[model samples]
Target: MNPIKLNLTGSPREIGIQHGRALYEQIRSQISIYESMFQYTSKISWSDVRDIAKEFKSPLQSLVPHIYSEMEGIAEGAELDIFDIVALNCRSEIALGRFSDGCTALSWKKSNNARVLSQNWDWTATVKNNLAMVSIEQIGKPTIYMVTEAGIVGKIGFNSAGVGTCLNAIRAKPMISSKLPIHVALRLCLESTSVGSAVKTLESLGGVASAQHILVSDSTQSLGLELSPVGNKYLTEDASGLIAHSNHFIENHYVEEPPWLSGSPIRLDRIRYLAHELIANGVSGDTITPGLLRERIFSDTYNAPQAICCKEDESRHISTRSSSLFNIVMNLNSEAPSAEVVFGRVGSGEEGPVLKMPWV
Candidate 1:
């Protein structure tokens, strides 16, 4: 694969906006909206909205006119305002589209998350400035093209202050399209300075969204948070150390699909096998490391739930569609109490130092 490598280092808010500008442009050419978007979805608590707005800072806001314009264009279909658009930029709100796309986050041990396997996936540019990376998959939607917001981040790479977030694909239609999409909300989680802040940002938002995600961070914590705008519910699974997540829901009352799922039972087993292998082999923050996540995510052979290759048998009329491996990984290998996002891709070259986030 002709993988793209990226290295960007600067202030936190600017880094966030810089990453997103391209996505705004791409969405513009693809989906033409007729009105302005919201700064926050209607159901989101006012408090959460306020905190995220603070994070955007003035400099970040300066670069948002393009996004605001896009919001105006898609407003007829989504019904959002420019303020909601700004809030989405700050990671305060999330847009849950039709069809349940999801995300999951879990913490493996620092020792386990630290491991680094040699990456041959050709992602040299991605490691730098990527303090975080994301794998984007659209099970039944066209809106989720590349993972970064063109780099804006509705969804983003894990590894922020020891917290990692991942999104999933599902099926569901919204009563009202979000002012902010799910990917943007998760990206906001990465921009948080602390795990507590990340948790607060993720759970408080309200909207209809499909999919599952496992958030892992600081090598000691992990969480599986689920959001369903249809059910108007959000749930989280906690762990003291190691954790795993699949495509379906693991909750009781809101169980629609299992987070531990995929296109087939075999796919489910495949992820389990890999998860077990990594953890058993001491996949700690000091061992397994973030680079491995990229390698595994793009692997044509063992990436599990293969992209869309034809199976070996004739009766298998299976559609080998690509799910979540559509985006990049953000490996946040921090060097101090303050985060210095050492970004890189999972499948890229040997993990190396790239951008040192100016926020540090």
Candidate 2:
């Protein structure tokens, strides 16, 4: 299925208005799915979810009012309360790692010097149709093209400034409502001109609301930020210029993280092994392209349901069954940043048609 493509410009509010109005149906759909997800995963009612979400409003208004303004516009345009939009954005923190949404992210440099950032977003299939590719144009900020949940303000995508980001939800946290949510932090990274600038901005604010690993990259470099409310750690690339992260924390962060999903370690090893193969083959420049990355690394099925290209396990409950919802590979070239997205699991014949980014 073709995801709804939205192009938004103007101030944060105006851009948000376009987002809410265009994807109103999708936004509502997201709300319903999250309501079920929260009830099943966190055992929290939807009403309580919104009440908890309100705590973020004051923090957002004080720290990053622009993003709050965009949420306001979305509420007005979608005819819902601003807190509902906030709830969707903070779903990760509110869920408190009860829900395990697996993903594998990687960053590597091509022979021609383009930095490639890619990942497979694995999650429950119930809300797959609610995903949208949103492109934003704001004054002073870089143009953003992100694939996000209908009501979410920020997520995985690249920007005009050659900065791209991918998210891997780390199921370890003491959810702090006063800090910046992971989605909001992602928006900040996309708005940054380079990875260094993005890292500085996030570090200056302490850290994010929950534990998350955001792989930020540009034409020249890539850095993995393992952010939690308490502190943050940076995971650098290897000597070969490669970084791979799954759901678990690979660094020594003194955090209480038990591997909730057994697949996290298996997938990480599989991806790293595949990435090293590229170097062994003497692949560089033109040889190291997005297509090659998808075909080689992200498509592995080493551990079945827990592999890089995940598939739903029929034995699991409906609420918990998961699969790779979509696979996106971004080529962060300073001159021309672009991405290719494939809906559904990669290499699975059930996957949707390939779509290119910066459409138009």
Candidate 3:
């Protein structure tokens, strides 16, 4: 089935109330899923997770109160505790590099000047039922069309302003609750008018809670921001105007210990190879489009189970098995900014229906 679709507008609180009322059951499912994931991955109970979530309350309210208000709305709308919503927003931070979610993301500026950003979001298949496609309309912020988990405020998607974002989770250390959470950072990017403005917002805030790599693209350009609590780094597109990142840190980072997720390097190399090959072909004559990328690059399963379009392995333990939950491709052209979200593994026969963005 396609993920639940929601169009939310009004004040932050009202929006949250609508979201909460509309997806109350899904939100509850999301909370239950995370409660188990936290215990299995981080060896922490849900109560402890809530306690960890409490640390970010003040920072969120002080730094980005609108989002905090929106989150509060979600909690109130769902008739759940605010901290429950906070825990969902802060899951990346609370997990502390213990969870396993492997994703491969890319941003390509085609010779035709079409800016494209996409990724295969890999995670445990259990959360699939709770996923959602959210379109948010607010007074000041750009209109947002994104694929997000039930309770989290921000995630992968593009805005009407022609700004788009893709996320690759990085599991590096020295998490600081005072900084913005990774998912919230993606929300801020969606709210931005330009890639430069998004970068400025993240930089000014002193980076995110933990480590994450966010690929930001607009009508003009695409760049990757590798954020960590200690410091942040910028990765510009190559001369070919292509930037690809997997779970691991691509550039030298703030710490000596590199983040580890099995098969990350292999998946990175595989996708890069396929992308360059497609670019070469495109240079000769083949036009590159979101459909082409989905079929060629993301559909690849060169190394079963651990491939770019990941699949769960029966041999692996239930807690460790991960698959590509969805694939999203955005064409960020000022003339017509659009997105295509596929709810399951791209080429995996059982992939879900395709959902196009901007509603109309």
Clash count for each candidate, listed in order shown:
106, 3, 0
TM-score of each: 0.51, 0.98, 0.97
Model 1: per-residue Cα lDDT over 1-360, one tens digit each: 322323333433333343344234433321221011222224445344544454433423343333334333333223333344444443312332222222222234454333111111111121222323323222221111123433334543444344445554443333223333455455545555445666665555543233434343433334545555444333332232444443444452443442322433344345445656676776655454444653443332343323211112223221211223233333333443212122222233433453332222
Q: Candidate 1: TM-score? A: 0.51
Better of 1 and 2 by TM-score: 2
Model 2 scores what on Cα lDDT? 0.89
**Model 3 segments beyond 4 Å from truth?**
111-113, 283-286
lDDT of 2 by residue, 166-215 (tens): 99998885888999999999999999999999998987876799999999
RMSD value for candidate 1 = 11.4
Considering summed lDDT, which 10 consecutive residues are worst modelled in model 1? 115-124
C-alpha lDDT values of all predictions: 0.36, 0.89, 0.87
Q: Show model 2 residue runs off by greater than 4 Å.
A: 111-113
